[model samples]
Target: MAKPGSSGDEQLPSNEERGCEGIRSRLPLTTLELFFVSVIFGMFSITLLCIYITMPSVDQKFLKIPRTVEELRTLTEYVSKYTDSYKPQVLAGFCVTYIFMQTFMIPGTIVMSLLAGSLFGIAEGAALVIFTATAGASSCYFLSKLIGRPLAMWLWPDKLRFFTREVAKRRDYLFNYMLFLRVTPTLPNTFINVCSPIVGVPYLTFLVATMLGLLPATFVTVRAGVALNTLRSFNELYDVKTVGALFVIGFVSIMPAIMSKFQSQDSDRSHSS
Candidate 1:
């Protein structure tokens, strides 16, 4: 039994509060809409479009990073001989191309990683791959944010839903999940990129997760790169030894998560009792 005045008071909002709520709802729609429109109309979008148009004109197939041990061996020799000549530009082009493919969710990142190793050798290849991949993933994050969720949904429907749900439910342990994804080699790199932003994964988390998450697989592929000519099939990359190691790594990566879940259940039971 409340007084009439109390009922009236509860229903009323202060002038400032009502105004703020109105601004909030409209801002995401109005302001964000304009932001996306700007990107679509602006120089960046135009340049990207132009790049896409001109891209097909280039020798894109030849542009692929090499894969195979013998290819790497020969590439290293060539680089060694021409270190003063073709090193910087070649590496720069490699980085740019790799980043472009990844940012756009192009399907050849695996070959790119192998190419780095095949062309640059283990240490240098891994470094280049990691750097370019991180940059590309970051670019995707911005692109997704700029375009908004609808475009992301169109680009990656199933992944967007799965990632969004996983992130919402296990936000605190997101790093754990990211680690699992990275180690298991389940999803491709581009799938993770296009879908991550739609889920609202924080930029710092995405950056750190991607940077760390991509390393082992990159290394594995890069190592395979050092043997490209010797290998006939991509399957040779994970012939038994590598797969076994990957599983062990995956297990180690997720053990902490299992421990955390168990601890939470124990705490809940204690509280109830």
Candidate 2:
């Protein structure tokens, strides 16, 4: 008795179908969005260039991709030889590259962090890594919130569900959960940055949690830069021991949440009784 042009499933779109359609329609950036993204990137690049030019270092050939230890070693040695004269330019270059990568969700920031250690030593390198990582995350968060949500949703549908659920569950202790995610590497930072806005995490909470959570991993990676000469491969950077330490840190960060959950259960039991 159905209409000739209609099927049982064709009455109206389900929520799931609507979501899929929304994602498909939203994935592409609008003309105004593209213009904004390009303009921001251009301005950021220009600012970095101005900072570099004002510095004593006259060379800007310091930026290159190093795929192997030999290339990295050579690059490190060259930078070290002129650290006194090129320090400002090198610092500016690293910041620009890191922010650019984070904003655009590009890979290879690990290489840049490693280079930071090789060129600037431990303390300075770790600080640089943390600062740039946090700043870049902030940039990505705002960008995704405004114009990149569809792409983020499409790229990380499953992780997006998990993030949204966890964020909702931990309304009071959200920062701890964020720190846990950051420390354990359960999720990629880029995905977190992009998906967070869509999932309803507040910008301030994301910023604070990112700054706090990235410290241990940043230290490990930046510290590895101190030993870049001995490192055989990028895989070797996160050996079992390092991963164990990160897990431990992650566990500690979430302890408050764990305790709160127990307390909530206790209160619920009391109320039920």
Candidate 3:
């Protein structure tokens, strides 16, 4: 029985304070949503661990700093020794590592891609890279759509604006535009993966573009891996000629959209005249 305006009443939080508490406590992802994401992420980790434990001679240093050429070579050698007996585990470990990096937007996928090429040969490696990359990108897309808007807004406000406008402008040719993004180093694949949904790109477009778009780059990285023994520096992976060729391919992918816009303008000019 509190009295009106008594000292006891003064100690109680006001409506405004209660409202502020509610706002502060609210989470972007509800508990259930977070739990679901955690479970999926955990499954990947568990799968990797199971593969590791079953391997007869697990290199504890496997996949440690894949970006380093020496470490990559060592990892390749370590895995090569057991390929005949542990091929499934090797492939599983690679997929888990690659997908985990992609799902959480971690770096070092480049190293994994290179390792794939070096260990598995070019064709198989490229297929694996493309498949895992697409899977990871799709996972990120849905996760971001569910609970990543605020983080994306916070991390990439300006880039978000540019991407949004570009996506809008290229709505008819969205797949080609996405292909351009994937093939070129224009916007990072991670950024595109997490933000594409936020910018209104369809999942199918993202999937198709990612699968086809990654082929050229995957071919290059895997080919570089085939020669991993001779590579002194990681820079050798993407030399001037390789980069120029990629840019050329990227430009060609988007050229149709550009040509369409130009033809549209030409029609408008003729009509005005």
Q: Give the number of the best model, judged by TM-score.
A: 2
Which scores better on lDDT, 1 or 2? 2
The 10 consecutive residues of candidate 2 with the worst lDDT sum are 1-10
Q: Each model's TM-score, in the order given?
A: 0.70, 0.85, 0.84
Per-residue lDDT of candidate 2, residues 53-149 (tens digit): 6766444465566777677777788778767876776677778889988998888888888889988889999999999999999999998888865
Between candidates 1 and 2, the TM-score winner: 2
Model 2 C-alpha RMSD vs. true structure (Å) is 7.0
Clashes of 2: 0
The regions of model 2 sitting more than 4 angstroms off are: 1-27, 51-62
TM value for model 2: 0.85
Candidate 3: list runs displaced more than 4 Å.
1-36, 271-273
The per-residue C-alpha lDDT of model 2 at residue 67 equals 78
| Candidate 1 residue pairs in clash (backbone atoms < 3 Å) | 68-227, 68-228, 68-229, 69-226, 69-227, 69-228, 69-229, 70-229
Ranking by lDDT: 3, 2, 1
Residue-wise lDDT of candidate 1 within 1-273, one digit each (tens)? 112223222322232235434434433334666666566446444554454454324343433345644544554555445334556656766676777776666666777777778777899989999999899888877776655454544444445555555666666677777777767766666667766665556677778878887787789989887777676766677768877787678778778988999999999999999
The residue pairs in collision within model 3 are: none
**Candidate 3 positional error at 215, Å:** 1.1
Whole-model lDDT, model 1:
0.65
Q: Which stretches of candidate 1 lie above 4 Å from their native place?
A: 1-84, 239-241
lDDT scores in order: 0.65, 0.79, 0.80
